[model samples]
Target: MKRSLQITLLVVVAALGLAAGLAWQAWRDQPATVPDATGTPGSDARSTITSLVVGKRRPDYQLPDLEGQARSAAAYDGKVVMVNFWATWCPPCVREMPALEELYETYRDRGLVVVGIALDNGEAVVDFVDPMGIEYPILIGEDDGIDISRDYGNRLGVLPYTVIIGRDGIIRHAHPGEIDLEQARAYVEPLL
Candidate 1:
């Protein structure tokens, strides 16, 4: 029957799509490296990397928080700052938020500032953040988000990019991809 054949073809197509997605996931998960400004490949995902700006001071940025008030990076000067570039649509970015939130809550008293720069729009951002209990400042950056991310070594323009700056203002790490709490602590604790 033509109808049966059509259904079978649909199922086959779906399976192929899923296979491709899984393959991509596997590739991203591997210990991937993006080269530093000098073109030397890093040993792993979390490295002082791609931009010459890494190992330099954190860049100045002003963007509106969820409530529409302008926030300047200078406000958190002299603190250990983690700037995470994320979007609600990106699955890894969404998944990594809770850990970042936890890290913020734990170390804020010790002068740690976790800033989430969101690239996508809508009430869904507020909705997604509140119920999940994210208290760290979320800056909406739908307009200039990608450019800002690229400044700190997001050569691939990937979601869930993170840059950790020391209290002295030097960029300590620029990591592209998901980071676990353990990895976060390792990167942050010494600086704090």
Candidate 2:
């Protein structure tokens, strides 16, 4: 009887340990809170990070250009504007910069304006732009930058969020990752 009781107690302990382990594993699988496209607290779950509609109306905020002049969304009105939020450390952001510059060069004459909002320090951006020869304007942003991003529908602070606004000042598309040139062209062509 004593041996049987000991075995039963061991089994109960083992069951509890197994249950705890499973619970921990389940918790580990859950997504952690990170910056949303807008730089606000958000989750990384793909289901929650899909395309978010930002709608019309430009967000009002002041950010300095490389030359220290104040720039705002109003600066690019009546043009097809592509506002891209990126950081220096993001590999995808680096990869997309050349394409973005090419796109800007190709379409700038045709009324396309591209703006990059650097969600990092101004000095880092300075370092990034000089070597890459980025022709489009890049604005240095802070926490409030997320607010502008949110206004354009980027709730998850994911690097490389692009908002394309039409000539009417209405937001036409919001992409959360690296944008393909063809796909971007398709979205902007209608507005042009």
Candidate 3:
């Protein structure tokens, strides 16, 4: 009886240790949270964003711009639109602002419309724009930001989410985090 009990204890300990090891390995393999458009880190900072696949109509919805003017997805019809969801607090988002602005300027004449959706409600966005020389339209999203993001397939509500809508109104690609300029340029130039 004593020998049997000792063997069972050993097995239980070994099983627990194995379980812990597996958990650790899984955690280590997880991706880091991406910062929002600005330099501020958010609670969902460590999540990974995936690209939107082809063959889907771009999610359409109406949102208010910074001045509270109603804007709809249809406003950019017949043109290639880049919709970027960002916050002034996200570091990565801020880091890529200049690049995005430059990309917009380079393609605006070719029917490229870059719209920035600010996820934060505070005055941070208002302050960040001027210094960054952001020429595109910036809109406030408030609490409805998450809902708007979900409509664009960003279920995790990650900042710096970008979706490219082709001229035909099809969603060409949706990036959940920061925009890759090279990839963005490649996708937009062809659509132009």
Candidate 4:
């Protein structure tokens, strides 16, 4: 009986050891997860940024605003333009709206045009934009905005993606996440 008990204990220990080994192996095989401001799990920091390379001509596309007025990259050509792709639902996106507004207010008259593309449905974007008093042209694309963003180099569909286009019509920088006032100054001051 004692021999049988010893053999059962050995089997249990082996099974536990095998399970641990498998778990470790699985963990090792998984890509590293970086914490974002949204606290989403399994979010890859690298994949969040698309089209990191600068000096490429930005793809041109036309989208309508909440008022149904057409806006396009070409319309703002020969000006230092900052095209920001954002969604109303994204916390980080909402957080940076004021900073963007400030940036636009400060430089709009100086040949800097800041365009906000809102990726939201129906009147949701209008409702959000109205109270915020966003001065720059805001184009509404809804879900189709995802494809537009991908075309602009936001392959991961990340919110709060910004691309700076020099007056020469070349992309100077494409970045993901919220832009602080200082970063905004740095990006636009040189182009201005």
Candidate 5:
């Protein structure tokens, strides 16, 4: 009788585990629900960082690209621009790079431009970007990135910070962390 009871308990546990695994698999296969530019249910859509910079004309800066080319924010005045501040050492920054590249390519011909401000050395930025096949204009910020980030409204000086400027040169969004592709699209699509 003891052996029979033990077998029954094992069978019950196995069944429960199988049921949980199946449920998890089903949930994993479900599509992710993308939130719109407005607030999603149970969450405020407005970001404090964006609130600080939005509606203000983006500050101009001239930073050097990888090949010693001077790229100025002022030069992109008539185009919608995304300026992303990132470091090669930051994991979240690395993870979201591909998404940024894709977003840039998708909207480049539609009046949207994406620029990456790498807070790392030019050599390191080149090494990191080359492996990832990053094709956007990358500015080497080095140590001056802290001050530049502050000018862009990133008071805390977070990595992977992003600022979106509309075609009229007004800041639209300032985000301080990694952003998914869908969320980025939502922010840029309406302007295009």
Candidate 6:
């Protein structure tokens, strides 16, 4: 009976894992949409953004930093820009923060600008990053960040999405997952 129970538990874990994977994939492939501030269906945000590609010019947007100062793609002109969309509550996002900070520090002198867009409350973002010592500029987007991310070519609005833009204003790469220091270097050094 003990052996049978063990087998049953193992099967349940496997099934749960499979179900989670499937759910994640489905969400990732869902057609992009953004709701209004009133929580009603707004429209397909992808209409304005379209599907971005590696060679395409980075989309234009202006979001405020923690201090409510507006930041935009034009501000980073002639710089290697990495725009990362994340939230303070996401584990993967938090996990990669150190690596991103390190990447920003290592390449800032060489014209690398790592801009982190936090899709959450400004106070929460400030609280989280202050303890972590994240030096890169962080923009507060709340709900609109998702729409801006779609402009950057995130179809499903996934967290921890990163778009690396070259100094010429062309997007060089789009990384859509938690990144380590090694992966950051691999994607950034070539552009720098």
2 against 6, candidate with superior lDDT: 6
> lDDT, candidate 4, residue 188?
93
Scored by CA lDDT, what does every candidate get? 0.81, 0.78, 0.76, 0.81, 0.83, 0.83
18-105 per-residue lDDT for model 5 (tens digits): 9999999999999976333222322222365666788998888888898979888998989989998999999989988999999988
Clashes of 3: 14
lDDT of 1 by residue, 14-119 (tens): 9999999999999988996643322123644334353556678777888888898999788888999999988888887888888998999999999899999998
Task: Score residue 138 of candidate 1 by CA lDDT.
Answer: 93
Better of 3 and 4 by lDDT: 4
Q: How well does candidate 6 match the true structure in TM-score terms? A: 0.73
Segments of candidate 1 deviating more than 4 angstroms: 1-51
Q: Report how far residue 117 has shifted in candidate 2, in Å.
A: 0.2
lDDT of 6: 0.83
Q: What's the TM-score of each model vs. the native?
A: 0.74, 0.74, 0.71, 0.75, 0.75, 0.73
Question: lDDT value for candidate 3?
Answer: 0.76
62 in model 1: Cα distance from truth in Å? 0.6
* lDDT (tens digit, per residue) of candidate 4 on 9-71: 999999999999999999999996533523132345434443343678888888888898887
Instruction: Show pairs that collide, candidate 5.
Output: none
Model 6 residue 130 CA deviation (Å) reads 1.1
What does candidate 2 score in Cα RMSD to the true structure?
6.7
Tell me the lDDT of candidate 4.
0.81
lDDT of 6 at 23: 100
Model 3 Cα lDDT, one tens digit per residue, 1-192? 999999999999999999999999999999987445321233233223333335578777777876678888899999999988888788868877887889999999999999888888837667767677789877777777667777777766677778788899987866666666786797688889
- Candidate 4: regions farther than 4 A off: 1-53
Q: Of 1 and 4, which scores higher on TM-score?
A: 4
